[model samples]
Target: MPVMPVDRRTLLKAGGALAAVTIAGCTDSPSGHASPSAPPGPDVAVAPDWAGFGRGLDGRLYRPGGSGYAAAHQLFNPRFDSVQPGGVVKAASIADIRESVLFARKNRLTCVPKAGGHSYVGASSIANGLMVDIGNLRSMSYANGVLTVGAGARLYDVHAFLDRYGRSLPTGTCPTVGVAGLALGGGMGVHTRAYGLTGDRIMSMQVVTADGVFRPCSPTQNADLFWALRGGGGGNLGIVTSFRLSTIPGGKLGLFILKWTQSQAAAVIRGWQRFAREAPTSSWANLHLDARSDGTIAVRAVGVSTTGSATAAAAQLESFIGIRASSRSFSQKSHLEAVRFLGGGTSSPRTGFTAGSDVLRGPMDASTISALVGAVKARAGAGMTASAILDPLGGQAAKVPTGGSAWPWRSSLGVIQWYVGLAAHPTAASYNSARSWITSGHRAVAKASAGGYVNYVEPGRAIQSYYASSFARLKTVKRKYDPANVFHTPYSIS
Candidate 1:
């Protein structure tokens, strides 16, 4: 039976759209709408038969050959277009999440949660699996300086909601990234040094696990689950419904975009490695090394000083440049504007690309710096766009114990993100070229740094690379909460 895909705006109200069958085996919400815990178990057999799932759901469903089906299940990277989901369920609320989980569990469908759908490895969209699409659960609020974000809310919406109250949250640059996905994976951005990873500000969360139990997790209650949710990557132990996060100053911030010629690329990378590590917490910066079509290396640094003064940010950047930049642009804008600039403003460039990331513990020596430079140069020589970003990551972030959160990269001073842009239509040669470049680049920095960032997914890497020593504990948490592995992905704890 074919079904039409619909967004939340037009779902359910369309007459005779879906069979209105009732769902069974759902536990009552702990709170009035949806609230806390239940004992963990693998008792999904109690759920009503799976055939009634479409009729039992409170939102829209799209099967193959249905209208809008392709659009609803699309991944961020079109390169993964070869993969297709068995179906798409556009869940409208937490209750929908409950039903969706039971439906998957009862029927034995390999269902995965999807929010912003920005996962690099296509974890959000699985082949021959169900996509519990929560993109429509985007409710948000800010009161008394605290922000409550629905797990499905995109980064741009979160910013717009908070910006209205003259406040903001320390989040990533990509406007379309889901709040839950980024926070769960240890989100970073220009304000991270001044504040901290977005996950660090999470005060509480609502998660629905494999056992069909809806619960509230915080520092004091369900402590283990809460700790793991803060920094562990998404779609691992369970599906998060919402997050309660602390807010930060949302007024205008100063920005700087400094660029230097190809000859200055090595010196700039060398200088930035030293300056950013010790730079004041008031400044959060990143160095972008772009390899042009002609294979010439170009250096650019874009950042905010938190100082809210154009002069201060430029001067701070100048101190690191030491050598004169070929060009400089400075501005003082609202935090939202800064975010928009980084996200490339609405219509993002969709060239197929893949990237890898690592956490650098401290400053790199000259030899290590030269090796990194060599890696970037080799990728650029291939005639595709390539960039290596060095983002500072140590201020309040280092104060927390490595084990304090599931994100074990807390002790690092910076992150090295190696990326190679691919042709929109890639051949076997092009695919190997992009993959090999990033792989070699990662190896070149192996001695200088260790561990990887969960947000930038690599297809075949081990889970330990991202979680490090904490992987053991995360596995325990997974066993306790999701023994049956209902919510699983390529990088899942299992």
Candidate 2:
């Protein structure tokens, strides 16, 4: 039977109404309830046996036509607009994942592995394929300071779980980002300065390979596969079921936010470059410059340190900008709190936003910074807020051996992220500005950096440029793992 088409306006109206109702009275408190609804997209034909596949060995299947399917498809990134999978197999156990992969391989259909659904590029969750939704695989076990988390688990959940034992890992700030994609793609977060990317902390992984075989991977066994899994990007190699991560003792961390005006943009950026290079590994900073409504520029300096003392870190960072703060938000927060602040708490829904990223080895000159700021200032709109974020690299990030993993940008000083939000219809002018800013900003920063971050790439750019030096090796791995290129997406090696 052909699937019935729903009007785009109707879908939006329905989704908005449902969201408002579900989130109406919910507070931003950590204990607030999460609304369960299907992601906004056209309805697709689900297989007749979708219900059977949804059932676990325990006999409970979550079906797309059922209530659970609606809730299960709601992931963190909202840009993905394709239909829901023909069917969703909500894997409640590792065995379920194995069974689903085997079934999909035998049937000769495509399969997309979904963790937290936080894939900004929409690769984590797919449309019209066998969607192996892994949200229910939320088991966590800790022993001897090593934490083992299920792939379906979210970063915030891991933080809360480990916090009980006074331990933590270097995961990204977005609480909802899946551990599978982030860890597999070289996660960068608040603790990266002190501990390194989340990939560095991974001790082992329980993976379902492309051939439908289940095995444990680590540095000693399946060593080549282990290298590929770390920073090689997810889904291509296999479905990662669980991860064994190294954890550290939790302690107080300092968090500070300093703001500046457009007039001080050049000075602030130059100062940031010097500080990022010289600051101790214990200290980390992020530079955010957005356009204001009144036609002025706004620059915010955010930083965190392993040392409990904010005084020194703040002073060292503040001196570089050499500008008085228009506004400041600072606190001494636990690792969890720091993660929440950096991730932009639950109040801000991840909706209608387009973001792209690049890595920088050095700093942009004053003229480039000025032009970039002007582009952003002239393009502000209701749903549109264009800005750039610079995340410091080096320290432990560079210590990993060259060719140690597929992650190529170990020597990078920081990552440059360009993003814009859209509330209403995106006009040609708005899109043009975004493209121009991203291109110009990337080129301006590229003089200092060689390439871009794979996870944050926009559509239409060459994959070769994104991978740069590591493309050859990654392509070889792609051939070994996915020889037929069955698992292709925006940034797949193939």
Candidate 3:
């Protein structure tokens, strides 16, 4: 979803009414409420026994021309609305998930699972295929310092549920992202440096593999699958029904945002990198070079300190920057307060944007930083908004031993996201312009970047770029679990 990279409030601040698409299978709170109906799409042809298949499921099925078909197929990004699924199974239980998989395998139909519908490449939905929508399977419980969450649970609901027990999980800022996708793709967020990626905390999970078998994976049972499940990226090995993860104590955190003019971007970038590298594991800061509505870029440092005052953290950052911020704000906030503050305003259920990423190998030199700053400045315009966001990754995230999980970039500096939010109705030319800017940004940092983050997956990018050295092992696991390649996407292991 690039939810952590491109802030929706920042996108709105760039100035434009976002093209609205009725949201489906997503909610900002734990409570369930009826969703607005979407105009039904054209009737689609279906398998002869599709009705019988629907009747056998515990959850409701939405075939094309059905009441919920349009809403059932919607994803977080409206950019891929053209690729409509022929049918959707809103799985209500693990049994429903297994049945859906079995049905798809027997029918020889493409099957994809839709969690939070945040796939950057829209892998959550398939064209004329059967979609096993797990959004209805959201269920959560916390006991014995472990939180067990249904695969469909969103960040907001998860956090809310945990807050009741004064527990927290390392998660991205965006509240609507599915826990399954984030944890599976090596979740990175404000808490990354202190706690490590969300995948690192996963102790066990329940999955419905391609062969329609329900399996429990943990360090002691189905160990190989357990290793692969963490940071392997969802939809590659199976449909995850639930996850059991370790939790951290919820308490107050120091939050701060320091800003500087674009003139100070290069200096700020250099200084931020040094500070981030030296900052204690309890502190984390992300640099954002955002294109404003006025055709100028804004440089800002946003971070959190779990153990000290926000003012002290800000001062420490300033000491490294060697320059005073034009403006800054620091405060101590409770865990829930911090979550809401960091979530920002404008949590649009749907957004129009194209984003990609690069995982930094190490600190970038002055020249490379200059080129990156110049790239964003050159891309700023009236119609679209561009942002260069870098989230630090070296603290406890790197402590995981080699081969601890499928995530390969733990030893890296951070993930650099190149993002552009589009206009109400973007033309092909506009999309080309946006993509070209992303390409230019990539070229600027290609020397320092080792690979791309799987969560921020992009089309045409090599699959190996995401897994790196782990790709071979992942392919082996995939072959063993799904030899027929029934669970497949453009970037899925073959």
Best by lDDT: 3
Q: Estimate the overall C-alpha local distance difference test score of candidate 1.
A: 0.68
Clashing pairs in 2: 38-70, 54-61, 55-60, 55-61, 383-421, 383-423, 393-413
Summarize candidate 1's per-residue lDDT along 320-361 as a digit string, tens digits: 668867777777777777656555454333335556666787
| Top TM-score hit | 3
True-vs-predicted CA distance for residue 282, candidate 2, Å: 1.1
**Candidate rank order under TM-score:** 3, 1, 2
CA lDDT scores, all candidates in order: 0.68, 0.63, 0.75
Segments in model 1 whose C-alpha atoms lie over 4 Å from true places: 1-51, 347-351, 401-403, 423-425
Q: What is the lDDT of residue 120 in candidate 2?
A: 45
Q: TM-scores of the models, in the given order?
A: 0.87, 0.83, 0.90
RMSD values for the candidates in order, in angstroms, are 10.7, 8.6, 6.1
Q: What residue pairs are clashing in model 3?
A: none
Give the alpha carbon lDDT tens digit for every residue of 339-362 in model 3: 666654325457666777888999
